[model samples]
Target: MTEPRWLDTEEMAAWNAFVEASNLVARRVEQQLREQAGLSHPQYEILVRLAAEPDGEMRMTELAQRVVTSKSGLTYQVTQLEKAGLVRRRNCDTDDRGVIAGLTDAGREKLREAAPGHVELVRANLIDVLSRDQLRVIAAGLGAVTRALRERP
Candidate 1:
């Protein structure tokens, strides 16, 4: 096997900082969502995605893809949301084997209640920490990485 090239000091520092910041931000957001909204980060994301859809619904598999979650994970989250009367699962009209998840009115209400705290947490922990140019650079860098990963076989 070929010897692996290790990260240099600058690269190592950058990677470590990125990982640390990402973890801290996620934890803070999760805490705020759980405490104020009784929702997990993933649950909050699911609600947001559904809210953005034209019909406020999406196929389960599509939702999983958009959320970067496993099919089973999405199913479990949907089940939990259904239990809370925040979401419902329906049979897909055109596909017998497919299921769609639709956001309920209760879900929209919860999202509306949760959004302010969530946005504040995000701004305080992340967006407000960076300058506009830094934010742009960070977004471009992360987007490039995302595209590269998605393009990989």
Candidate 2:
């Protein structure tokens, strides 16, 4: 049997730091969203993506892909948002089997209200902590990783 390679000390330190930072950042963002907007981080992400669309609308499948959630998970979130009057589901015009989720005016307002605090939290936790060059390098490295993952079968 081939022996598994383990991370060296320096690599282990980097990996641990990455995991810790990621967890902390996610928790902070989630807390801020829940406290200030009564929204979970995932829901906030959905709102942000829909708001960016030309008509504040997107297919459920597309949204699932963008948010990196399963179709069932997106459906649940969308259903919750719908009950809160933040979003509505519509039949896709060209495909009877497709579902589209569109942000309501209330949803847009909620997003507008939540945006400032969210941006501030992100800056406080992440952006402001890094130099411009460091940010650029991190972005490039993460972007490469994201692309690779998405391209995998």
Candidate 3:
């Protein structure tokens, strides 16, 4: 068996820094969303995806995919949002077996209100910290990684 190579000093430093920064960014964004909008990060993501859809509606399964959440998890979150008058669930008109989640007018208003804070948080924690050149480098590097990973066999 061949032994796996380990990261050298410089590589280790880069990897550690990237991991720490990624975690911090996520935490900061989550905190900002909760503090400014009374919404969790995952909940905000769900609302954002729903808002982007035509008629602000999508099937439960589609919502799960868009938000990268499990079906059950999405259902639970949707239920909570519904209770808040932010979203509602209904049977799909064309398919009896399918359920659809729809964003409410209140949801749109909440998103509109929350967007400024979210944008500022992102800019303050991540975007503003990067130069244009650094942004281009990061975008190209991460885009390549995602493209490679998303390619099918």
* Candidate 3 residue-wise lDDT at 150: 51
TM-scores of the models, in the given order?
Answer: 0.98, 0.96, 0.87
**Which regions of candidate 2 fall more than 4 Å away from where they truly are?**
none
Query: Model 1: per-residue lDDT, tens digit, 1-153?
Result: 998999999999999999999999999999989999999999999999999999899999999989989999999998999999999999999999999999999999999999999999999889999999999999999999989987897
List, residue by residue over 27-140, the lDDT tens digit for candidate 2.
Answer: 999999999999999999999999999999999999999999999999999999999999999999999999999999999999999999999999999999999999999899
Ranking by lDDT: 2, 1, 3
Q: What is the lDDT of candidate 2?
A: 0.97
Q: Using TM-score as the measure, which candidate wins?
A: 1
Which scores better on lDDT, 2 or 3? Answer: 2
User: What is the Å distance of residue 112 in model 2 from its true position?
Assistant: 0.4
Model 2: how far is 84 from its true place, Å?
0.6
- What digit string (tens of lDDT, one per residue) describes model 3 on residues 14-59? 8998899999998999998888899988889989999998899999
lDDT (CA) for every model shown? Answer: 0.96, 0.97, 0.91
Which residue ranges in model 1 land beyond 4 Å of their true spot? none
What 10-residue stretch in candidate 1 is worst by lDDT? 144-153
